[model samples]
Target: MDYTALTEAISSKSYEKIAEMCDDLMLQGSTEGVVNNEDWPYAIHLLGHIYVDDINSARFVWKNVPRVVKENRPEVTAAWKIGQRLWTRDYAGVYEAIREFNGSPEAQSLVDSFSEVYTKRMFQLLRSAYSTISIQETALFLGMNEEDATKYVLQQGWSVDPASTMFTVKKQAIVTEQKLDPSKLQRLTEYVFHLEH
Candidate 1:
């Protein structure tokens, strides 16, 4: 069946276009009562997750539908409709759906792999840019409040002024005076040096 050709076609298309393609493919496959290939179902599930992430934008392309309606059926169309509504820039909705989806047996089976890829990409970005970040900037980047950021920096053995409430560049003595495990100390030293230079 020329899977590469289909993949290229899907990749070249916009998200809505891809969703439409998946729906059509799934419906056609269902009519035959057999989807011999696993890719279509996975693609459909992915489309659902994407849709749920950005409902308004997704709805601009695909319309509003009931969430329960979307969830009841495991069909690609239903999943796509739900995904269209679920995945969004709205952090609250996204977070809730992530919790809900990850709790589901079907989603759990896929989420570990999905999250591994996501974490790797996030860490790559963090490692590339984090060292250049100032304390305030790092706080904002990490979505932490100023107090939390200050506490975190101090916890890492950096001096922070209590009165001025600023993170100082000077290294501070460890509060506990306990030696770090050798391997961990080496890693910490490497990280500190990387950040310093």
Candidate 2:
């Protein structure tokens, strides 16, 4: 297994090739229940990029990766570290992981391509916690200037006032069933007796 082609595919930022190589390596590692040690690193090295492209698929892959395999492969462990950082919204830790992987050509390639992906994902994550955000905060999170952030929010149809620097995201209204009043339920016992007849 040369693995040079896989490295080249990552370095070139060929998404299709990267996916194929990940699949191929995974298959090779598990074939006949005899795993090749090298395939673990080669496949684990691409997880960050995979996460950027398809988070659900990345989660599926992460879940399937055996704990034993992750412990034995540095790249697998490194990817796990990144996943932990991502789960906790630790941006600094994520960047640190990228830096840590810089020595590995394939992992570094994935890290370099993930800059845009990370920013978009950060916004998605923030929306779950914040229904409204100020222009300055959005700018800081998105790595853009305040004016641009304001313009972007306005373009996205966020509720904004010209005089104010904050915008509000319109979240879906939650609906709940009205609670029953025990005092109003006068005689459910009578109804039960009639049903028995």
lDDT on C-alpha atoms for all candidate structures: 0.45, 0.63
Per-residue CA lDDT of candidate 1, range 1-197, in tens? Answer: 22453355444433334445555665666687765543334533354335334334434333433344335444434334335433433323333343345333433433433333433343344445444335565454333556775675566555655565455543323467776699998999999999999
Clashing pairs for model 2 are none
- TM-scores, all candidates, are 0.33, 0.51
Clashes of 2: 0
Listing every candidate in turn, what is its Cα RMSD in Å to the true structure after a full C-alpha superposition?
15.1, 9.3
- Per-residue alpha-carbon lDDT of candidate 2 for residues 147-174, written as tens digits (9 for 90 to 100): 8766766666667755776778755457
Query: In candidate 2, how many Å is residue 125 off?
Result: 9.8
Clashes per candidate, residues 3 or more apart or on different chains:
14, 0
Q: Tell me how far the alpha carbon of residue 177 in candidate 2 is from the true structure, in angstroms, after superposition.
A: 42
